[model samples]
Target chain A: MEEGKGEVKHMLLAKFKEEVSEQQIEDCIKQYANLVNLIPSMKSFRWGRDVSQENLHQGITHVFESTFESTQGVAEYLSHPDHEAYGNILRPLLEKAITVDYHPTPVQL
Target chain B: MEEGKGEVKHMLLAKFKEEVSEQQIEDCIKQYANLVNLIPSMKSFRWGRDVSQENLHQGITHVFESTFESTQGVAEYLSHPDHEAYGNILRPLLEKAITVDYHPTPVQL
Candidate 1:
């Protein structure tokens, strides 16, 4: 295993407000995608809408995953103006939001 | 946007037993990585240990993310023999487990 290759992954789970239209959610996702391009610390970003209908999710409707070079990189992304703007758009529409950040080490196979 | 390119992403949140050694958890991860290689439906797999110490996770310590071609692909991965074996090993170590599966559409920038 390579040394110091550890990276942080940020996962966000969100449930939208009942009044929020699907179009608005799509627009928010596009805005996030655009924000990723602007944030150098965000190495990658992906978002998805729940389709499994699984009870395990407890009504959480969407998941967003992003990678950063480290925990510091994650903090940088969080403090960036673009991220703040994105949150301003997203927070009002969210009924619930949960976030988890973790450091990933590659598993040897 | 590309037509019919939407993919399913499976996110798993887990907390290990208090008695479970870190080495055992690492071993389970490697086993899972091996299983992903054997399961054709699993396009990608990544796992991480919580580093953020944020209270939002409510003691959840690990996050795993995987991608498949579709929801059907996710089902195939879950039901596959290799996955079952991997779960057999992992379940015993897990104190809590939560999963969410979603379909991700590429956002137009």
Candidate 2:
């Protein structure tokens, strides 16, 4: 890794929305498909998958993945209007929310 | 908040661990009670509460809340031996993992 090369830092927020049907969530997943294309710094993206296969799931709902080239890049991504729009659309439906941030250190290959 | 008092930035990693019994996971919650006592910068902490009273809970397992005064503080907490040890114990059992990070902006209170 170059000594002055920039780093990858990302901040993630997760909220669990209630009373939303699978079809509605699926529709949002599809909506996100279009949203992802608009964000320049969304280096990685994915969603939550069912691990339990049981009919009941309590605390989990949406899972998302994204990456940024620098801390400022993350800031730019977060502050983007479209990104905030996604929040506006999703926030009203959530019952629980959790968030964490990570700065990925480069691995020596 | 002072002009440059510092900021809180935390990275959260969530994974759905499979084949882990509820009792074993509950035991872990007890173990973490001791671990949280060790990390000084952890300003906020809590666990996931069951939103659904149904028989099956598929995606959710453990919910952890932690806080850091600075990014470096978060780094210190993450690299702590106790935290690493927790990872050692829990990694093998995980089936799915999701991670996100957040930087809390100071709000006018």
Candidate 3:
């Protein structure tokens, strides 16, 4: 694929602190999802709570996956003022957070 | 959504041992991706390397995402012989692995 042309999946794995309430996490997720609307490059957003039977989550309870048309779109979303604002609301409640971005490659075999 | 009717994304985050060769990891990923073809419930497979500028990954180097039609489909995949076989090939090369599954919910806001 051409540079910055492939689809990128931005994955955020978060584990809320024990003291954080469910309502706060819910509110944080809602705002995080709204970034899709606030930033044009953020094409779509979806999220989920951990549901695996496998004891391999390493305490990460929430997974937020967002799609961008290209890496540039992700960079734009990352630096956008709205994301910064959302982070301010989210940072205090998190026990840990991990973010990964990639240009998804399809496997035919 | 009705029980087992929504889509489920199974995300695997892996960090290979320092001693593992690059080719070994590549082979492992290719085998993992091919599980889509081996297991009927595994609807699609895609993967990517960490490209995030942020240092939040906590050692996760690769992300493998597989989509299933429903939770039941994922349960079926978990017990499939092919996945078990793939696991045998993958587990030994990894220093750490985290797997999480979720039925992705769209954010309306």
Off by over 4 Å in 2: A1-15, A50-58, A106-109, B1-109
Question: lDDT score of model 2?
Answer: 0.49
Q: Candidate 2, residues B1-109: lDDT per residue as tens digits?
A: 2112244423234455667777776665555545657777655544443222222223444335455676576667667888789868766666644433334332222
TM-score of each: 0.81, 0.43, 0.92
CA deviation > 4 Å runs, candidate 1: A1-7, B1-6
* Candidate 1: tens digits of C-alpha lDDT, residues A1-109: 3213458878888899999987888777778778779999988877777766446786788887787888888888888998888888889999987789876555657
DockQ value of candidate 1: 0.52
Give the Cα-based TM-score of candidate 3 against the true structure: 0.92
lDDT by residue for model 3 (A13-99), tens: 989999988878778888888888799999998888888878899899988989999888888988999988888888888888889
In model 2 chain B, which range of ten residues has the least summed lDDT?
B49-58
Best by DockQ: 3
Clashing pairs in 2: A11-B101, A12-B101, A100-B12, A100-B100, A100-B101, A100-B102, A101-B10, A101-B11, A101-B101, A101-B102
Q: Write the per-residue lDDT of candidate 2 for residues A1-109, one digit (tens) a residue.
A: 2112244423223445557776766665555545557788755554443222222233444444354565566667667898789878766766755443334322222
Q: Encode model 3's per-residue lDDT on B43-108: one tens digit a residue.
A: 998788888877888898988889999878988999999988888888988898999998888866
TM-score order, best first, reads 3, 1, 2
| TM-score of each candidate's B chain against the true B chain | 0.87, 0.67, 0.91
> Of 2 and 3, which scores higher on lDDT?
3
The TM-score of chain B in candidate 3 is: 0.91
Per-chain TM-score, chain A, candidate 1: 0.86
